[model samples]
Target: MDQKIKSVFDLQQKYKFELRKTDSKTRIAKLKKLKQALESAEEEIYVALDKDLRKSKFETAVTELFFTYAEIDHAIKKLSGWMKPKSVGKTMSNLFAGNKIYYEPKGVCLIIAPWNYPLQLIMSPLISAIAAGNCAILKPSELSNSTASVIHKIISNTFEEREIACFEGDAETSTSLLKLPFDHIFFTGSTAIGKIVMEAAAKNLTSVTLELGGKSPAIIDDSCDLKKAAEKIAWGKLVNAGQTCIAPDYVLIDEKLEKEFVSHFTVAADKMFFNYGKINDEVFGKIISEKQFNRLDGLIKKAVIEGAILEFGGETNPESLTINPVVLTSVSAENSIMQEEIFGPVLPIIKYKNLQNAIDFVNSKDKPLALYIFSDSAKNQEKIINETSSGGTCVNDVLVHISNPNLPFGGVNSSGIGSSHGIFGFKNFSHERAVVFQSKFGMTKMIYPPYNLGLLKWLKKLM
Candidate 1:
């Protein structure tokens, strides 16, 4: 216990570090090590997530395990190139000179992972931090005890604590951890708590990257492939029991196609629940916990009282944290469910008379991390993409946008401030140092100081 406490202190003291000398070979080797650890401990990881979130083995594999390993693979394959110096274009005034931007590790960083995507949230940022060559301290969500412990065990057992440390605790401990001045802080969770993290970070003026969730609206144009759209939305919303931030918060569709949309959606749900002939043992995953369960339960009751039509799977199973997916129709804007982030297996299908109204409704709320529009029409897709100011946009897909490493992940307004993933992720955790080399002979001096008043006046005007 004493050693652990001391280690934490050491981690906090050295909040900034130059991770393994920014060498291409070294960076590649570290990413490979992370991959090996993840692959070797696959079963262990799945079991832990299952124990904490009552997560299905399949959900565990899809949401957390695979994504993390893919990020690691991406980092290993691209770290060498990303670490290379980028040549910057010279300004008109400095035509003869050269300027380049160099990426440098921003000392020590603190990554606070939320309970929803415990492993993925924590590890995804780590891939970038490692590539950027920064020592990091990761704080896993205390709510997900099993996964947190597994992460703590693996990180502690496999790597040196100084280079990367995993601290496990409740809110108080997390608050204590935040007191340390880190060079950069990356957080993923609700906007309410995201504000708290940002405020705490302000004490040190540390740069922060927030990945908060908002009401991300998915628009289904009239020309869309309804069968494909319904199938994708159902799968995404129910995955991990709709705990995903990018899961279709709510879907917008043409009022004429409402019934058709509902039919396909129910069918997709049935197919997911009763996949093949066998019941998909882990089809609709469990709600994270009873507190979360109660929160969602309240919304369901309120919506029901407010005259929202409910379909299948709204019942709660405490033993398994299993709350059946609830498909709500005729849900109006005034309904209680519409007021909050329905972070459960509840899909509220809203109908709009015009596409502009759908766009207007989304704009009225806080800016979302992602905006997904399923449309076959090029014009409609362009309209949504061009009109909305979201962090990321997917033309015809749902959560699949997040899978693409080429795109940066983050929210715009209330959703979040900074982005992560790919090059965006590396730059988020590291600071790009602008470098300009000058010669000792000063050959570039157009007006050297001979105490000339005329030269001083010209330089002032130029500046």
Candidate 2:
């Protein structure tokens, strides 16, 4: 094993017991310290994020820092109650026994976060791991080196290496870390890499929480407010340049509303970014890397070449690593843009005659991380909610569902596996142990191997 890997194992062994035995107060205190560290380093974090992804200060505050703080506060407030053993109802078989479920720590854990929303992804899961009384090794995506460096510095400064450590490297380093046996692994990235992480965890029989991404869709019905839907969809799609996992990848709209929806969406995009002619740098963000930019550019180019209408914005600036917010019409399911998750500012608007067509189209694809419906009709919402399955769903909104710490955020099947956020996150990092305290004269004694006629009669009567 590499020295770093060996060190991590040695530290985990040394600290696992202490972590598991940590009182609620100690855990809260640790969380508070982490919270304070983040506050003190807020400016540095903003700078790092801007350097890495060109995230504006306001966006950084809302998307990264504020979200993490909410998780911390939520964990701190709920940790005491979460740590207390829950009493369970007794069964007839344990008539004289007391039963309870204890939430125990899952020992050393690993959190592999992605570059998109880098800080929040890592810190949110780490908060739960800490609250659940587990030592952790956080591996931030190396693509966001500036943010990763800042995170490493803050965490190392606030926490002892054994208590919480940050590893920095590329895919090879992550592969090396995955070779070690961690009690649990929490991964957030593409489905392709999630598979690799799961396979590695299987080698050690490690429990895993994969927060992978797929092409989440947004359905707009005629009963809904078209302008409002366009605004929300545009906001969700343009934020982080639509690199977010749950951002609306495409729009499924009623065939009649297609022209109106595009017009409204164009207006909303222009108003949100205040860019009428050229791309605006202040409100918009650049792609994280040249490769990602090229990939997005290629998708847009192929869609246009295949005779799909570019409703608006297919301009790309290789030097700035930016692609203007794009809207496409006349897109088919087999179109290159529709074939994969478009983790960019490209939104394909597909026309459907009715609600069932929209639902059918979504179901035909791999289950998505999120399903969005922009309709005021309660009947439609209920029908869609019941018929389809996803990691999460939001009605009349986009991306805001993830802001609720009370809601468990994750994906299903190809989208993702396992949930996280607030108590769900705590449970993910914990093992619920069922405990039973038996009385000296337990009923089991009567049912022991030496069964007599009288005992058999009593057993039959009980049955």
Candidate 3:
């Protein structure tokens, strides 16, 4: 094993019992301290995020810092109830026995977070792991170096090395860390990398919670509020420059409303960016890297080559590493833009003759992390909700479902494999161990090996 990994493993092993024995008060205190640390380091976090992705303070607060604080508050408020053993109903066969399900910690855990929303992804899972009474190792994505550095500093200052250690490195470091036998692994990244993490975890039979991305779609019916839908979709897509996992990748709209929807969407984009005046302004974020910019550039070029109409904002400035929020119309399913997950500011609008065609279109692809429906009709919402399957869904809105602590945020199948957020996150990091206490005078002796007519009659009576 690598020396660094071995040392951290040894530290966790030495303190595993101490960590497990932490009372709810101690855990809550730790969460409070973390919240304070984040508060104090707010400016540093903003600077780091801006340096990494040109992310503005408003975006960082809403998507990263504020969300982290919310998770911590939720965990602190509910930790005691979550820690209490739940009583289970006793069966007739075990009338004198006490049955319960205990949420036991999974011991040492590893949290690998992605570059997008770097701080929130890493800290959210860590909050649950700590709340569940487990030591953790945090591995922030190297791509977001500035944010990763700030995170490492914050974690080191706030937590004891044995309690929660943060490691900063590249792909080679992740490869080395994965070889260690962690009790649980919580990863958030692309589907391709999620496969590698799962495979590595399989070698040790390590439990994992994968938060991955896919081509999530938004459906707009003629019965919906077009202006409100347009504004919300614009915000969801433009936030993080449309690098969000649950952002509307494409739009499926009624054919009759296509022209009106396009006009409303264009107006919404103008309202969002008109004041900023340029793509490099603070209101808009730059692509994370030159490579990502080129990839997005290629997709846009291919879409145009294949005869997709560019209705608005397909401009790319490589020097500034920014791509304006793009709206493409007349896009076919066979277009290169729709071939894979477009984790950029490109939105493809596809017109459908009927609502069933929209549902069928979504079903034909791999299940998405999120599905958005912009309709006010109760019947339409219920029909879509019943017929479609996704990790989560939002009605008349986009990207806001994840903000609710009551909802379990995760993907199904190709989108992802496990859930997170709130109590679901706490349970994700815990093992529901079934514990039973058998009374001294149990009923088992009555049915033991005395194969006679009298015993058979007794069994029949019990049945």
- Separately for all candidates shown, the number of backbone clashes (residues 3 or more apart, or on different chains) is 5, 0, 0
lDDT of 3 by residue, 103-159 (tens): 989999999999989999998999989889999999999989999999999999998
Estimate TM-scores for all models.
0.93, 0.98, 0.97
lDDT of 3: 0.90
* CA-lDDT, candidates in order: 0.82, 0.92, 0.90
Candidate 1, residues 214-283, lDDT tens digits: the string is 8777899799899999999898888878899988888888999888988998888888876664335465
- Cα displacement (Å) at residue 189, model 3: 0.5
**Poorest 10 consecutive residues by lDDT, candidate 1:** 12-21
Residues forming the 10-long window of minimal summed lDDT in candidate 3? 273-282
Candidate 1: where is the Cα deviation over 4 Å?
A: 1-20, 275-281, 440-444, 447-463
Q: Enumerate residue pairs that collide in model 1.
A: 15-108, 16-107, 16-108, 17-107, 313-324
Tell me how candidate 1 scores on lDDT.
0.82
Off by over 4 Å in 3: 452-463
Q: On TM-score, who's better, 2 or 3?
A: 2
Tell me the alpha-carbon RMSD of every candidate. 2.7, 1.4, 1.5
C-alpha lDDT of residue 217 in model 2: 95
